[model samples]
Structures are given as C-alpha cells and as structure tokens.
Target: MIKNFHQYYVYILSNKPNGTLYIGITNDIQRRILEHKQGLIDGFTKKYGLDVLVYLEMYHNVNDAISREKQLKKWKRLWKIELIEKENPKWSDLSIEWND
Candidate 1:
C-alpha cells in the first residue's frame, strides 16, 4: 500500500540559460510557477524576474522535496546548469505549456 503518498515538487526558475536561478519546493508546482510569472509572489523571484521554469522534480514527501530544494540552493552555478541541462537541454520554460 502507498502510505503518505502526498507529492511535492522541487523546482528551479531562471531568467535564462546559465543565468540566475531560484530553487523552491511547492505542493502545487503549476500554481506556484504561475504566481511567479504574474509576480504575485514576492521576494527573490519577483525581484530578479526569475519566471522561467527551467527544472523540476517531484517527491513523495514534503521533507524530500524540501531537502532537495535546500541542496540545490547551495549548489554551484555550474552544477545547477548541468542538472538543468540533463533534463531540459534547451532550458525551455516548462511552465509555458501549462497555459498560465
């Protein structure tokens, strides 16, 4: 049986490829990304215009997602770039197709 199957997301936003990155964890990735795009959310993302969803990962637990978010936050820029490219080579805005 799948116990505590709640899912969470750890996502990365960027201004552009190889640009400023923001790592965050959210239970609703699509909504959160939309908020970032509309500048509804304050702080680093809004201030830096980090609206592009370049990378994302899902976890079964909030703690796992939060842990990954914190780990990615401390990663060197190059490492983060590599990680993003691994999934999104073009660094495309994954949220674009979300219709927000």
Candidate 2:
C-alpha cells in the first residue's frame, strides 16, 4: 500500500499595507501566486493589482482549505486585517523571494 500526501492553501493578497485584499485557495500556493503576479488571473486580484501575499494558511484537506477560504471571504475587512497583522505585522509579500 502507498500513501499520498497533499496540501492546500488559503491565501490573502494585497497591493500594499492597508490596501485592497483578495482571498483564495489553491493546492499549489507557489503556482497560484505566480499566476497572480504575472497577471494570468483575470479577476479581482489582477484588477486591483493585489500581488503581495500578506497571509497564508495551510491544510492537509482540500475541503478544510475551501471552508476556511469561504469563511475568510465573508469576514469583515477589519477582522481580516487583524488576522493578517497577527501573522504578518509588516504586510510584506511573503513570496517576495520565491523567484530568487
């Protein structure tokens, strides 16, 4: 028997500190972030220039990740900001160094 491992991500992107935010979930965080950065995603993130990865959560189950993403999307803006700030006080792009 073989066991397969999988990962899912719930992520938040912002243009800058205290800026417009976009929430999403993906099985591949790096690829998803790259797509957003390259403007391949034609929606809120691209329109708002929200390429900075300010917050992220990982899950082993895709369903859990999806649920969390939906929950975050429904949260108040201030509450979301607080959640991001709790883990990323500077609102820096967590994926900034991925290319290098």
Candidate 3:
C-alpha cells in the first residue's frame, strides 16, 4: 500500500548511529519521519535525538538508492553536515504536520 508511486526513498537523519540516526526508505517521507520526531516510532529514533531532517535524496530507481546510500555511508562527519546544510540550513525538521 505505498503512496505517490514512490515505492521507497533513501534518506538520512542525523541523530547518530544507534544513538540518533534514522536511515530509511518510505513512500511517504514527510509523514514517516514526522512520526519519528513525535516519538511515534518506538525504536532508536525515540531513544536518541534523531528527529532532524539532515539530508535526503530522491531516486526513481532502486539502483540509485543503493549507490547513493553507499556514497553517503563513506562520507565524513563534516561532509554529511555540509550536505544537510546545503538544503536545510537550519537543520529544521522538514516533516509536515509534525509539531515541535
């Protein structure tokens, strides 16, 4: 039951690995992450502070997903931060319907 025809997505949220990071794919990106920020997900995202929409890349095909993920994974901490800042300078949560 995926929506928008976007079967999945490749996203990067900065909390930390197991500490706060949220790397996942979903058709409804905005809604899914909003759930995380609201502590809706009873997992690592809630335990840590991984509620920020640090970085996100869209892909029409899964191969792009695999490639981009691998690229991001190898990036340095500063590099990751820069990438997020490029689009989300404030590090604000881009999740709509998600309240602070």
Best by lDDT: 2
Clashes of each: 0, 0, 3
Model 2 regions more than 4 Å off: none
Per-residue accuracy of model 1 over 3-79 as CA lDDT, tens digit each: 66587999999998888999988998888888999999989999999999999899987888888888888989899
TM-score of 3: 0.67
TM-score of each: 0.91, 0.95, 0.67
Q: Give lDDT: candidate 3, residue 73.
A: 78
Between 1 and 3, whose lDDT is larger? 1
By TM-score, how accurate is candidate 2? 0.95
lDDT of each: 0.91, 0.94, 0.69
lDDT of 2 by residue, 1-56 (tens): 87789999999999999999999999999999999999999988999999999999
> Which scores higher on lDDT, 1 or 2?
2
- Clashing residue pairs for model 2: none
TM-score between candidate 1 and the true structure: 0.91
Question: In candidate 1, how many Å is residue 38 off?
Answer: 0.4
- Candidate 1: misplaced stretches above 4 Å? 1-4
